[model samples]
Target: MSEVRVILHTDKRQALLREAQAEIRENQGRIPAGDFYARKLSAAWRRARGTRAYGPGEDQDDIGEFSLERFRDLPVTPRESLKAQPLRYAAVTPTEASEYYETTGTTGQPTPTPRLAEDTIWNTVSVAEAWRPLLGADERVVILLPSDVVPVADLVSGVCEYLDLAHIRAYPFATGITGWDRLEAMWRTFRPTTVFVAPGVALQFTRLLAQRGQLDELSSSVDRLACSGGGYTYTAAAGPGPSAARVGLARRTQGRPALPGGEASPGGRHCLHRPHRRTRAGRPG
Candidate 1:
């Protein structure tokens, strides 16, 4: 199948982001504590085959009590089925979708996932809101993540544009394009204050700077580092010595609890990173 071009309605998404941020602020970051998922589940019950196995119950007519037992009763969709017949799990048809993305197929066949504009807007707004406290107008962002055939890069890029921050897409892994040398050159010229990078790439780039004895010169300018994708090690963003403290880099799992050096944010497992500090970027746990 031919690739579907991604149309990012940046202006509209940005306006939505702003609206979402305003709503979040007004609500004090609190969401309806009651039956949120149940409401959605009730609405999707008729169309969602994943829930078709459920026996009829009187409570199914409305937003029923969502208990662990009730949830446990729902049938799990196997990966094979998802790969072979993705439409079985979809709420919208691929034709109705505005954007398309695919899994890496590392586990099996690549699964095609189509998304609506609402998906992009909601995801970007939620993530951007979580990270908003850490970013500012003066922040120049360098994204060292893949932009081809995946949604991760787009998500971060959307958040950057939504927040009106200056950012560039330069993946070091894209050899002959934004290779290590090119990335280093760009780093020097761009002097990015913030970076959203993959953990492995962050380590590789840090090591490159160390080998050239430019760690201090180059790293000094970077105040914040946010990493996603792959297994992360503390040293990936910390570099060596007191640089962790100097740069304010701390590693935490997303959405757990705020680490000692980091500030806490609500929502998602990837919220444990200390956004208030310039140095630590982990999946905020």
Candidate 2:
């Protein structure tokens, strides 16, 4: 019998459903892409309108006229780019934040990303809904990402806790707080059913295992391997990035672009152990 007892709080449920509904309606042509997008930006910008990031009412009125080019003038910036001074992008103060998590500093010195208490609450509920159908209580999970200060991934941990699933942590690798061999040993001992890791880290470990002639050590129990850092849906040339890791794949239609050959299909069901050629610190943008 399945032991999963997933329960979403009403506020969190409504928030997530709202986002999903909006996305579905937009994709189904019920909402005009440009005008609806402008309104969304206008709403978010309106929230952050009086912050240091936006610089006191600058670009306030032009929110409804938003265009793709308007991205250059938006008050928001990617968290990675603002890592050097993370709080500068925040609308709230440190006292209001619940915790802070730092990047692995693979490119340079680490940058800290802070989150409020409400952020964690929303995300915890969000992950439970998004991942519940794909995960089972009987399964064990191995998370290959940092968790000391509770980043977004921590919300997944919350789901694990709720479902009473065994979740093994391989955190220190991202921060160099621990080493690769330790992680390899844990994989051998735990044999996790689900593995969550960034794509770059996954490739790096693959190379290490292949060089050590231990490719077969990869767990067969794993039915789901979620690679984080999915990155931009659209590329710089205005093309979609490689859909190598779509977990909850969008609706498929004739005109819609299907995932390229050799990618994880819908349902998070996947096969691991294919050797990737590149070795990098973490997933690239």
Candidate 3:
């Protein structure tokens, strides 16, 4: 098994590192060992370290002698820096590349992130490992998200493929209310044990389905509901209320609780606010 550990100032980083380490140890000897993402990050860290030197002779000294204090003094690389040197920034060559992903660029320009082939494989493996406990061997899964292939959807699809589960489906809903009827049709036909959705579309679908008394149609087959694409607020901007409320509705209808640590917006009605009990009560079982 390959093991990769990341250390950051935050506890969240530490916890993630531990989880990754545990995953590595769990699969040790079965795969190449080491953090692929960390390797890329470490390369960036080295570049940051090298740029911090002040004295004339500092350039000639071995990296081992490079002071940690100087490294700490290095200016952080901005998104533009990564964008400026995408090729140099990569830890591994394309030969080891399995997939390419991009930031949605909602804030600014999108940045393309490349994944090493092994990292992609391990990612699917990790997901399968986590999901195996929750999902049964015979359970069916349907992925309903954007048409454009995103990393999260790709990961979910790849994991389903790896598991060789009996039924796995993908229906592209894109953004907004563009494909509600099509999505509804697929929902009826697939009757999946799992359903994944983009945040905005998930919310819209939840509202529409609830209004039409069709929410239970989805809940009947889908026990697990997964969503991604920013927080509920960002998602809500694309349509109605926060994505979390939509997620909560999906979970409640399906008889499950929402996943923790999802993004939130204070005083945001559509993204983070819980649905009104009256609204939920009026919905059909």
Overall lDDT per candidate, in order of appearance: 0.57, 0.49, 0.49
Clash totals, every prediction: 25, 0, 8
Candidate 3: residue 114 lDDT (0-100)? 60
State in Å the error of residue 49, model 2: 2.3
Question: Candidate 2: where are CA atoms >4 Å away?
Answer: 1-43, 55-86, 103-105, 108-112, 146-152, 172-178, 230-285
Best by TM-score: 1
After superposing all C-alphas onto the true structure, candidate 1 shows an RMSD in angstroms of: 7.7
Q: Which stretches of candidate 3 lie over 4 Å from their true place?
A: 1-75, 92-96, 105-107, 167-171, 174-178, 230-285
Candidate 1 regions exceeding 4 Å error are 1-23, 26-28, 40-72, 104-109, 230-285
Q: 1 or 2: which has the higher lDDT?
A: 1
TM for every model, in the order presented, reads: 0.68, 0.55, 0.57
Tens digit of lDDT per residue, candidate 2, span 1-285? 111113334576456646744553345424456676666666556545445555454444534343557656655667565765666556566676565555442345555655554445444444554455567778888877544333435655665775578886676455565578888787888887777665555656655665665544463455566554332112111012222222232222333222111111111112222122221222322
lDDT tens string, model 1, 1-285?
111113433777557656756755554456744765565565456444333123244354332355546666766757677777766456567798777766641234666776767666666666666677768878998877654545666776777777788888887777777788888788889998877665556667777776676665677677766655332223233333334323223554453423111111111122223223232342212
Give the range where candidate 3 is weakest over 10 consecutive residues by summed lDDT.
262-271
Q: Best lDDT goes to which candidate?
A: 1
